[model samples]
Target: MTGAPPDVSIHHLRAITNESTVELPDRVVEILAAVGPDTDVLVSDVSARSFAAATRRSYSKQEPNLVPFINSLQALGDELVLICQVEHGDELVTAVVRATDRSLVAATAIDRSVGIVHITVQELCARLRASNAPGVELALEVASQCLADDRVRIFEQGALSTARTVLTKYTMAAEKGFDVRGLDGFAGALVPLGDEQPGFCIVQADTSVGITAFTPGNADVVAAMGIGGLSLHSETTEETG
Candidate 1:
């Protein structure tokens, strides 16, 4: 895996809910059919409760840009469908259309970009507690293991606060050239540790994690986690709030 080209574009789609049952639109079906076998695709119900049978490939490659796919589902005007395509050496393309009206609600192409670093467990715990999102105790346990180990695997639905904590720690570790891996299904923003550096805040989509730091040596690990890489830089200064 290599760094995403600096010129990569980020796209956005709206998120809406549909409670009716509707057939997959022909245009969407066509797009899915047009996807080459070499391309990786994942189709899931709007609830993301289960991945559709269309998911045909390992998620080991670049993380699929899901913003458009998720957001467009609501516009489908009935049942929602998510289609994420990742092609070799190409930008992630995600699009969804309304089956009833045949209108393209959202489509976007995005490439992985940068992320922050070097926070202590105490501070991490403080932030988690401050978030007031549920599951702080469990998040603390995960954070302790994450800080102490080179890699740790967590298989659980983390609370929003838990996700934010992991994102901060993982980005921080990657910045320090440590090989970090494995956490899924959480959402949060990357807040710069202090005011000296530009304040970079990213409110990521659900089930997506972004890496703010990475070296050539750890690219494979970063890719395996299916998280985007951001190139932001920051100091090791602690957060006083």
Candidate 2:
């Protein structure tokens, strides 16, 4: 006989700012808890598990019923907050919102296994940050500029070795680099160590390799290699420049 389905669980909860990662704050927790046990929370179907699937399943027009809920989360502050809830053998719900004028960037539910919820959320966060976060925009801009310059080719002697040197130069120039843990295509934050700025590089791995850098107020020279698809080997931090 088949075993009973797994119970609902919160797979991930964290707020990301330009500076650091913040655990679910007390106020935000209270708002979510207030939805009450009896509320019929809308969750996505199991078939839409990956990012593409979730996007396909997303509502073309925001549901009026969800507006208040989204607003409540956005009211918290400007920090980008992500919440992921999973019910094994059933549905998964994820919400991402922030207070840059307070809007919901993403709210989706998909069929997902409990084992992979963390990975799913990590990817979701990375994509959202890359496309939306101002800090990430600045970092990518720096990277793109480096790619346009021929001078960046000086470090292409070895793929992996060049990647390390590139990252090292970036870390040194930025003053620090915060390890981004599980996300591919993301190396780390290349902002000043103590400054409250948000800047990060996206490294895509391929035959060649290089690095890039960014500063909050002024631009600085970094590194660059090649470009195509995005992939980052966690251990080596190797990716396309």
- Candidate 2 per-residue lDDT, tens place, 1-241, comes to 1111122223222232112333333434443444445332221211112222223223213333344444444444334332333222223344453323223344434332222211122332234344532334333433433333222111111122223334444445334433222112223332112111112233322421223333321133222222322234433232222
Q: Write the per-residue lDDT of candidate 1 for residues 1-241, one digit (tens) a residue.
A: 1111121111211111122233333443444445455443322123221121111111213335443344344333445433333322223344433433323445444332212123344454444445533333334444444443233211111122223445556667567865444433222221111101111111112323322211122121111122334233432211100
lDDT of each prediction vs. the true structure? Answer: 0.30, 0.30
TM-scores of all predicted structures: 0.28, 0.21
The Cα RMSD of model 1 versus the native structure comes to 16.8
Over 4 Å off in model 2, which ranges? 1-70, 76-208, 211-241
Q: Each candidate: how many clashes? A: 9, 8
